[model samples]
Target: MATNRATKSGFAAEAQRKVNAKYSEELAQECLEWIRTITNEDINCGGDMDNFYEVLKDGTLLCRLVNCIQSGSVKKINNTTMAFKCMENINAFLETAKVLGVPAQETFQTVDLWERQNLNSVVICIQSLGRKAGNFGKPSIGPKEAEKNERHFSEDKLKAGQSIIGLQMGSNKGANQSGINFGNTRHM
Candidate 1:
């Protein structure tokens, strides 16, 4: 008899355990609440991975969430259950997130959410979106977004910068070769 994924012990199970360690229930609850409030629709999904995957697998809610963040981010949300259409919606949402300054590393692949391969990644993607919401002057779900600090340099500062070399590129401004000479140096 063949065992199902839930019972089978394998690499998938090990990976899931590792990811689960990093998953935060508090954050997930916040993400769900934010989604509901922003889209004005209650998500039937829960903090559980299985339920979360099932609801988001269709990608309709994800599209709606993105559109709420930025109007017209996702033009068409497929209501049909076709696999490709669902994937398209997920892909569109991810693309919109990237365009809006969400780091690519923080996003998930289509299969990660659709196939339930990595639901934690999906949560992380959602959390990243929440953090970025402030860019649009919208409410956020997770921690407050970090503000951008742009520094301005005067003409003198800019000229001084041209004459100085950055320390990263082997700029030996001070003493060297004082006590630790190697490679066939006779001892004094």
Candidate 2:
């Protein structure tokens, strides 16, 4: 007889750990309410089923947001459309920052704020809080930019960019923003 290697119910889902760190329950509730309310909106799925699904896969991610909302680890800023854009998903946690209350436009206007304020952490938080959030809209580098920088490209790479390859050159930021990465094809 073979020993049982697989277990049912996914090996008894991990137990919920107590939230040891301090968190604002009120803010989390507000964020969840926002997600729930949006779920019932035109963007939910029924209005533009295809696009909505394209944006928010099933209601599963939305549900996880609700749980985070109930946890009060997130908050809302005046509850406006722009606010929704900035803090709609896991990004809501950033809304708790005092500056977030100062209107989304101004708060996000300064690139320095994004860099110094740890916007990357906000992005990571969104990724962790929901099934998928930060992964959305990751820039894709194109072949043209790649050829412009790579200094040497085979026939394949040249054909991909309509050039002889290795003939052109470009700046790092230009190549990156173009979504060009010789090492990573996932962006392609």
Candidate 3:
């Protein structure tokens, strides 16, 4: 029994080491520090920390953002329109982070994402929260809330369609009057 237990423990340790080897220890630690700072959670470099690294590797939105930042894919362009579009993407990403349980207000406490220099740091913070939150990050809405939203959208669409039809009818009336005016002017 002792030999069996020892073998099992050895295998577990080996598996952990392999997992740890897959991620950059420096990056993982940096991300953890940001997580601790933002969430005020007491996280360390082992135990639950390993789970953070695992989650970071799992390719969530935060992870993808980090990958984009790290790969130099997201950069400032000279074009104003492109820059505005980039800001829009960042805003959307931040909102998504908030929905995913990232304490976004606290995360941005020390840095502004609009500044290009702070983007990499922002990515680290987001990725850290994504790692810590795991499956809990997904936003949940009750079925009744969803149905209410659907009804509201349908009502808005119906109102828009009615307004468009009214505009078309008004334009047709103007066209009929213009035809009558043209015939009278020709006779005159």
Using Cα atoms with residue i matched to residue i, what is each candidate's TM-score against the true structure? 0.75, 0.19, 0.28
Which run of 10 residues does model 1 get worst, by summed lDDT? 1-10
lDDT of 2 by residue, 1-188 (tens): 00133432432322211111222333333333344443344333232223322333222344344334343434332333242342344233334322222224322222211212222222223223332222232221111111245577799876787754353564355344565466875743
Instruction: Name the better of 1 and 2 by TM-score.
Output: 1
Q: What is the lDDT of every predicted structure here? A: 0.81, 0.32, 0.43
Name the Cα RMSD for model 2.
Answer: 22.0
Question: What is the C-alpha lDDT profile of model 3 across 1-188, one tens digit per residue?
Answer: 11223333587677646643444455545665554544444546332433443333212333344323333332332223344554554555455556555565435422233432233345455554445343443322212111233434577787887656554455544354443453355443
Candidate 2 overall Cα lDDT vs. reference? Answer: 0.32
Error of 1 at 50 (Å): 2.2
* Candidate 3: stretches off by over 4 Å: 1-25, 28-81, 109-114, 119-124, 136-188
Cα lDDT, model 1, residue 27: 64
Q: In candidate 1, how many Å is residue 77 off?
A: 1.3
Report lDDT (Cα) of residue 153, candidate 1: 96
- Candidate achieving the largest TM-score: 1
- What TM-score would candidate 3 get against the native? 0.28
